[model samples]
Target: MKLLYLSYLNSFKGLSREVWWLALVTLINRAGTMVIPFLSLYLTQDRGFSLEDVGTIMSCFGLGSLAGTWLGGKLTDRIGYYKVMVWSLFLTGVLFIWLQMLESFYAICSGIFVLMVIADSFRPATYVAMSAYSKHENKTRSVTLIRLAINLGFSAGPAIGGVIIASVGYFGLFWIDGVTCLLAALLLLLVLNPKKAKELDQVKNEAPRSAYSDYPYLLFIGAMVLLGLIFVQYFSTVPLFYSEMRSLSEVGIGLLLAMNGFIIFVFEMPLIKYLETSTLSRTSLMIIGLAMTTFSFFFLTIGTWTGLLVIGMILMTLGEMITFPFSSAFAMDRSRSGRQGEYMALYNIAFSISHIFAHNGGMVSIANFGYKSTWYLAMIIGVMGILLLYALRYRLQTSRKK
Candidate 1:
């Protein structure tokens, strides 16, 4: 037990204090992530929204994410990461309070759109700050640390949210979520202090570089969008499966969802660290990750038992553990010094695209075609992602030789 515990500490050792603090910020921000994970359920059960209605509202969030990602990328480069992070965090929390009061479909949808725009704009700046603070060798691990904190918070959020809904209902979820967003921003302000952000290891001489012009990077982003389409099914459609098909209760579904985060928390860091000494190229690692992702849905398609659900969750999470952090690290490596934020923002746009596909397409598909059909789509998309990511290896290799 002591040996195991000591290894975990050794993994985190040597990353800067700023990196750890950033991870704390991620933890605080995600712990209140109650609104989205439970959104379909809240809309369907409480507000009596049809799947289509929920889909449309989510599409609004996706639209806002697209707009916000672009705007955030531009702003991160122009305004510096500190100001962008501060305002994005503060205003996003304020918007959530506004969102809680609105009732009409259009009103709520509009509110969600604006809220996502403000909230997601923080992402590029956050990436910029991470790149600024992280060392070259530890870049992927830095992203992983933040992801670890996020998953830990996610593990806690739904467990608590299940209670919040059982007692005070969805209203409590929103209020608490808003407070936590504010709390995360406050931590960033108190610890980093916007004025002293310059003390971080920023790229001192950055020439302007356009990410769009990089064809290899563009192809990589395209591959990620397809991968995300497969992945976001866990968020948008899987809950519906456990509810409608598997007959899991609300709390049961929350635990089922928490399984993803808990698995990542346990296995991902150690696995990444182990791969450091292996001969596999980063792209080879991504290929393996995508292959694992492709098969997870196929395995889920086999049966809906508790054992299968556990298996499916484990495969999907291991797939995510393998893909997301490494992909971000690759994007960071491909970026020109000053252009890292733009690259990360473009990479994140894949997420926005998947949100559109996941909510609008995933919901509508399941509503009409059935859950098995949805998993089939996930399987096919994952296959396509693997092929594209395979092609990406050569591009990256060629770039490396240049």
Candidate 2:
């Protein structure tokens, strides 16, 4: 009944057409993202690889993703966001085709690394483009809209993916994903060409300095890494634990993951609007979110009950809803103008580190310590993130006032 809550629905009214176009492109791309969520299963069950190998291979994807964002930022500053997105999209599709052909372990790892580098380059540019296209007042809502698209797409993706894995096997996922990545590129080409958003975007003429020069931004990046490390376990670790330890089937795992996106799709925007209308600061919001994230993991310490997972996922979804968009908005606000792409790229380093450690360490944790211990670790890290963000409130408040 509350699916069409008026406040959240109203949040969309003032956003620009270009922002919606960007979101449409994201929805298209994410809707096809079947390969990642089920990759651990495909690697272990199909390819006959060990969990250690799977973790290492997934880390390669993380490394490539890291390189892509850095390169995308550099390219965006030089050649522009449009061309950067176009090539990134087109190339990622082509690589997915190439990825399916490679059979050897090393070849698959190397290919996945390359494919991810090409694909993930799209992220920072999208962030840069979204910032450029939205009015300053609508920035948070605009970013939230894009995330809404992403989560909805994700909700559809895994449900469809669950079916695909049963019928056509893992190969279908790559082809479908590749084709849709190209389609998204086409959408970007037609709608987000050189003719758009010249005025709304900040004019970037000056040569940029290193992001390291901003001490507070560096601190922000650290906090971001901590947060990512905590949440990312939901992706790789949670799936593995459910499938291997709890003996849940692939469909069950998919539904659990899909539930995360569904919760975000339904609730995040209204909650964010509520936070905005109140006196809650971005730092305070992140603190509350991290606290929720920590609490979610605590539920996992109970035996692997389906009821507990539903509760845990809802809490984590709420936490993700509050934390991510505002953090991105805060990143844009914190950046010294004209270097938004570079700043966002630096911001994404948190994701890169989390990918490496969460997968690598998480796999190891699951192999050795068991599920309860891993959940305990996530809870501990979440608590640490909350404390760190609370201490950084002064820096964040000062940036907002400027």
Which structure among the candidates has the greatest TM-score?
1
Clashes of 1: 0
Error of 1 at 359 (Å): 3.7
Pairs clashing within candidate 1: none
The residue-by-residue lDDT of candidate 1 on 1-402, one tens digit each, is 898777776776667777888889888888877777788898889888898998788788789989898788888888878778878888877887777788889997989889888888888888888877877777788889988887788777888899999999998988888888898889899887756643345575446678888887787888899988888788768878878888989998878777776777877887777775588877888888888887888766786577888787788788889888888888877764437668878988888888776666887898899889888888888888888877788877887899
Q: After superposition, how far is residue 24 of candidate 1 from its true place, in Å?
A: 1.2
lDDT of 2 by residue, 1-402 (tens): 465666667867878889998899999888877788898898898888998898788878888989988888778777777888889989988887668788888998999888888887788888888888877777788889999898778777888999998999998988988898899989888988877544475755476666768777777788889899889888878888777767889999879887886777777777776677778878888888878888998877787677887788889988888899889888877654547678878887678878777766887887898888988888888888877787689776777799
Error of model 1, residue 345, in angstroms: 1.3
Local distance difference test, candidate 1: 0.81
For candidate 2, the TM-score is 0.87
